[model samples]
Target: MASIGPNEIFFLLQGLKWTVALTLIGFIGGGVFGLLVALARTADHKLARRITAGYIAVFQGTPLLMQLFVVYYGVALIGLDIDAWLAVAIAFTLHASAFLGEIWRGGIQAVPKGQTEAAKALGLHYPSIMKDVILPQAFKIALPATIGFLVQLIKGTSLAAIVGFVELSRAGQIVSNQTFRPLTVFALVGLIYFLICWPLSLWGARQEARLQTASR
Candidate 1:
């Protein structure tokens, strides 16, 4: 068996860049769409709430890998010339948006009912209430959960490999096949993922603590 060498390490590092890029793309796209979903879920209109709830249920109830597969192939079947990277980015954005929407919806609901009442008393309409009074507090409540989900999103990018994206996990598989050292290659992969995720976890924890302290 060949030993894991600098070349193998370098290839994995290259894959890491794609993984990070996918994560950022998914998170930014998802966050924007999720905010809209959250607002729809929290709206007074029953039709909007029902539609958003169904969307969330479909995404959250399914596996992300299957979502990627469907998106990759379905687009092709429909005559779109999308690549694996684009498919993965699209699938991950939808998945992240669902979970993030639910998290933010919870945060929005967690705000005191009286706050909404007071905003209404001041003649603030739905948009004004949400923008000026509700969203600010809900954002603080959502920050920890948002960051926590972000770390999960990073790890989830590994699923992109199944759709032929060749991200970090896929890179480990490639190096392992070449070097015939699956254990060493995967251990390094795990370490790299840990290195990426641990700080986000810690930051989420720190934010949670700070928010709690401020609330108290």
Candidate 2:
């Protein structure tokens, strides 16, 4: 069997770009959709809140793997032509949106009731108050949580490998199969993931600390 060398490592690093691309696609798409969902849930109307909650429930309640599989097969069953990357991106966005929606909703709710009362006392409309006062504050609290969610988002992109989206995990598997060194190849992949994720985790923790300090 041929041993891994610099060329193989370089090949693996090329796969990292796809992983990062998927992570970016997932985060941006999920964040925008999630913000809308969070905003709906935070709206004054009961119907809006209930609808958003149901969306979250369905996405969060089901397994993400199943969601991916359903999209893959379901699209084909419907005679729709979809590529693996597109399928994975859609699945990731759907899954991430639910969790991020819930996280932002909690942040919105956590803003003190007194803040709302004060906004009303100032002759502000609900939208004006939310836009000018409450949401700004809520976003401050949401920052750390959002950052924390980003770490998970990066890691979650690995699931794309399931549907033949040759990301980091899929790249590792390819290398191992070619080299016949599963343990070594996978261990290196794990190390690469750790290198990527550890800094984000630390940064998120620091952001959480700063927000808490500012809160106090």
Candidate 3:
């Protein structure tokens, strides 16, 4: 068996790079879609609200691992070829959209009713009210939760390994198999994940605290 060495370490770092890249793709794509989901959830139209609610429920209620499986394998079964990276990206984006949408919906609803009323009094349309007055404030309210969800999304990228994406967890598996040192390989992997996630967790907590203090 090969000993853990610079080569293995470099491989792990490369995997980390992919992990970060995947996280960003999921976040940016999800953010765009999630904004629409949030808007639909809060729309005046009951049908829009119900449809978005069902979308959120389906994604949120399902296991992310299963979702990844369906996206990665199920698509191919339908005669559509897709790369593992694309499949994983699609899965993560869908999962993140559902979660982030729900989080932002809460933020939107938490905005003071009087503010919406005041916007209406000023002859503002629904779009203008939300765009100018409601969304900005809702974003602030949702910032902490959003960051917390981002941290989750970062860790969740590990699941991409199941679909043959060589993320951090998969890299560790490879190194462990070659080095015959599962403990050492996984310990390092866990540490790397901690280092990446702990700061974001702390930042989220700090943001929550600040919001609480401001509200007082």
Candidate 4:
């Protein structure tokens, strides 16, 4: 036991704040970017769709850890300050955008063709058709998956610690380094993650159930 105390627990708990904050930053930033990607992918322009597809493929194809490393060290190589928070935020946003864009694209396509035809008959343009006719119904289908993605995003924040972000997992590492108790520290950290994610999983399931009922 290497001097574990209330202060140490407090330190770890404080790091939890960073973890939650970083998760939100990634979620919101990625969510907006993802919506754009999804829209672009579904656009009429073949070249635009292809370019967006390539962007998604590259990000989704690579490991997120490598992306994190690139963000951390790549910016440093260019003589930018590139703080841990900004680096982690940008990396996770790009990562989340790829996955979320795909999720949302699936939802948009899942909408019935009849719906688009009906909207077109109502004199709606593509943007208005998507906004007024498609997105509303599609969002119902999207809710469960989006919530599930949020859980993944939260868990993914643990990776931020790898780049010295001092979030939850890093807090555990610091504690483990001092106490030499990786199992206990990491186990507690895992439990904390579970506490955050399990409820989200349940909520997503419930959302899916309700949507199914409504659609039927």
**Number of the predicted model whose TM-score against the real structure is largest:** 3
lDDT of 2 by residue, 27-128 (tens): 889988988899899888999999999999998889777888998879999999999999998888888888888888888899999999988998999789
Model 4, which residues run further than 4 Å from truth? none
Flag the better candidate by lDDT, 3 or 4: 3
Model 4 misses residue 76 by how many Å?
Answer: 2.8
Clashing pairs in 1: none
| Native-structure RMSD, model 3 | 1.0
- Model 4: per-residue lDDT, tens digit, 1-216? 776689878988988999999888888999899999988888889998998899899888998888999999999989998788899999999998888888888889999999999989988999899988888877778989999989988887887877888999899999999999888888888999999899999999999999989879
Q: Between 1 and 2, whose TM-score is larger?
A: 1
Superposed Cα deviation of residue 203, candidate 2 (Å)? 1.3
Tell me the whole-model lDDT of each prediction, alpha carbons only: 0.93, 0.87, 0.95, 0.89
Using Cα atoms with residue i matched to residue i, what is each candidate's TM-score against the true structure? 0.94, 0.92, 0.97, 0.93
Each model's number of backbone clashes?
0, 0, 0, 0
Cα lDDT of model 3 by residue, 123-157, tens digit: 99998999999999999999999999999999999
**Cα TM-score of candidate 2:** 0.92
Score candidate 4 by lDDT. Answer: 0.89
